[model samples]
Target: MLVRLAVIAAALLASTGTAFAADAKRLGRYGEWESLTYTEGNAKVCYIATTAAKVTGGEKGKNSTFLIVTHRPGSKSNDEVSINATYTFKKDSSVELQVGALKHSLFTKGERAWAADPKTDKAIIATLQRGKEAILHASPAKGSDVAATFPLSGFSDALASADKACNIKR
Candidate 1:
């Protein structure tokens, strides 16, 4: 777990648009997931993150992909889901997140994708917590289709840690 967290921290440090990741403090690691907290302009942000367990197609091994669920108490935002892909997404495209029999679409912007609304975010989080894995299907701006799989082994624990840190109720 330490090695994996190290690798994830390295990726986070090297990535762009991570908000205040430089000041993020580790909460804990559960399975393949990790929880952290950071302050963004005086607002505390608690989140859980996990890298793609497997990526296939479209420049597969060359991109960095991860899934994140964040909470912001100041804004009353909870269970905000975001998927980050190293490459820019196709213009006006939507990414598909599938977990077990549940499927949802997320609007794309640059390298990130998100649920259409807070309700959708909650739905996605619930699905993720109950499922074992999630598969994201996306189309990049300059490449073929890609599918990234994320294991949900520690998702529940990670989210719990984030929620506790943010003082969010369920």
Candidate 2:
């Protein structure tokens, strides 16, 4: 009876471990990122630091555009993140990112995309919701890739800045 009990306990531990691993994976998907803030003309801008990746097949990759908006007094500026590279997502779940002289394939799971950069030795990924927000997941892009994630708040700040600069009251 003791042997049988031990077996059951071991199985339970294994299952629990798998569950924990899955949950940990989600944690890497979305979060906050530290980026540079600058002023362009009358607009306050923010751009996340990034590197260029590669793309192929004459397909143009997607560029990182402003993603969020917040309008309040005193805080009036546009924020944007540098995509580093451009990527194109096909209907077949294949994605590609192009940066400088390099191009690489992107891995997509559901609404998320990931890629590893050989040059920078970091993993570059993004989680995007249609018509909602895009969070860039940047890592070392090389050996021991550690993701430095960035959330959507920066994008929203940029939008607010633009709106205020343009005097669009709504």
- Candidate 1 is scored at a TM of 0.92
Candidate 1: tens digits of C-alpha lDDT, residues 24-111: 8899999989999988788998989999988876664556688989899999888889987777889999999999989999999877
Considering every candidate listed, which one attains the maximal lDDT? 1
TM-score of each predicted structure versus truth: 0.92, 0.23
Query: lDDT of all predictions, in order shown?
Result: 0.86, 0.29
RMSD of each: 1.8, 18.1
lDDT minimum window of 10 residues, candidate 1: 10-19
Which candidate leads the pack in TM-score?
1
**With candidate 2 superimposed using the best TM-score fit, by how many Å does residue 27's alpha carbon deviate from the native?**
31
- TM-score result, candidate 2: 0.23
Error of 2 at 139 (Å): 6.0
